[model samples]
Target: MVVGATGTTGSRVVARLSAAGLRVKATSRHATPVDGARPVRFDWNDPSSFDNALEGTDRIYLVPPPGSPDPAAVMLPFLRQARAAGIRRAVLLSASAIPLGGPAIGQVHKALPDLVPQWAVLRPSWFMQNFSGNHVHARTIRADGTIRTATGEGRVGFVDAEDIAAVAVHALTDAQAPNTDLIITGPQAVSYGDIAAVLTEVTGHTVTHRRLTHESLRDRLAADLPIEFATMLADLDRAIAKGAEDRTTDTVQRLTGHPPRDFRAFAEREMRRPRSRPV
Candidate 1:
């Protein structure tokens, strides 16, 4: 079962698992049908959606709802129900910035070990998709050829969502649980400036990274997002400026037997895709 089946990573997980001939239950609030999988309506705020979604599924790929300030409060009850219903394994999509017991889905990461016999927490680095997806960074780049950040020159090993989904598939289907947290990352760590250069090279646009103070970044973000959320995002950027994400790991290669894609490769591929209507 894949909760948030239409999400960035969950959708890919559904496709990969279904292609492997595994029975997959793909759930979302809308219950939209996914290719080669069963569709079911599931909402974190609605407990009634839980029983039907978990029925007959042995394992699940869990993705916390987007914009959720605290995911554990919404997800833990469902997880408890899933455990009581005989679900054996779970793969949680968490973030590298949030440690187990830190914040957001981190609490779920800390709680999963005792809830299931077989489980894995995927603590992936910043996603490469943020450059192309419906995020503020992507929108800003598309609009004015600028990528704003409080990260200054800090670098991140931005892993692709495809790589994250591939790793999730392995974590879900492997004969034995990995029994540990996987810090998945791209082949290299690159700065926002480096990403801007890659975008410029690939798209023929003079994209640039605009470094801002944490306060400025937070205020700018607060225009469209909740103040608390904006503050949290800005805090992450502040962490980056302090060299929080300036590293790489081989976890993706070790688990999937293939080295993760680098930023240049991702940029090339993204530029080739059909462009979305400008924001």
Candidate 2:
């Protein structure tokens, strides 16, 4: 089962699992149709919707509820139900910024071992997709050639979503479940400013990084996010600026047999992809 089936990593995971000929139960709140996978209605806010999705699949790929300051309160109970329903292996997609038992999804990470027989938590670095995909950074880059953040000059490993999905597939389908937390990152660590330079030079997009103060970034995020969640996100940026996320890991290559895509490669590939014309 893949929760948040329509999301960035979740959608990719569903496709990879389905293409591998595994039965994929893809769940979204609206139960939107996805090619090559079965669709089911599931919502984090609605606990009653959990049973059918969990019972139908032996394994699950968990993507935490977006924009929630603390997802464990909702996620843990559902996970407990999944274990009770005889589900075996589960892979959870968590952020590298959040550690096991730290906060948000971390709390769920802490309880996963006790809740399920076989499980793996994928703690991936900041996504390379943040610049190329549907994130606010992508939006601002499209709108004004600017990627704004509070992360200052701090660097991030910026792993690709596809790499994350590949690792997840192996974890879910491997003969022996990894049964531990895996920290995944790209081949190199670079700052947001470096990302902007790459896009500008290689992709022909004149992008620039705009660093904001923590409070400014928080207020900007508050325009679309709950104040509490926005504050927490801004705090993550602060942590990054302190060099907390300036590290690399070889988990992607170790697990998936290929090095994670660097920011430049990711940007160039995205720029080369054919874009859809607006209707």
Q: lDDT winner among the candidates?
A: 1
Tens digit of per-residue lDDT, candidate 2, span 179-220: 999999999889999988888887676989999999999999
TM-score of 1: 0.96
Clash numbers, per candidate = 0, 0
Candidate 1 clash figure, as a count: 0
- Residue 36 error for model 2, in Å? 1.3
Which pairs clash inside model 2?
none
The root-mean-square deviation over C-alpha atoms between each candidate and the true structure, in angstroms, is 3.2, 2.8
Candidate 2 lands at a TM-score of: 0.95
C-alpha lDDT of candidate 2 relative to the true structure: 0.90
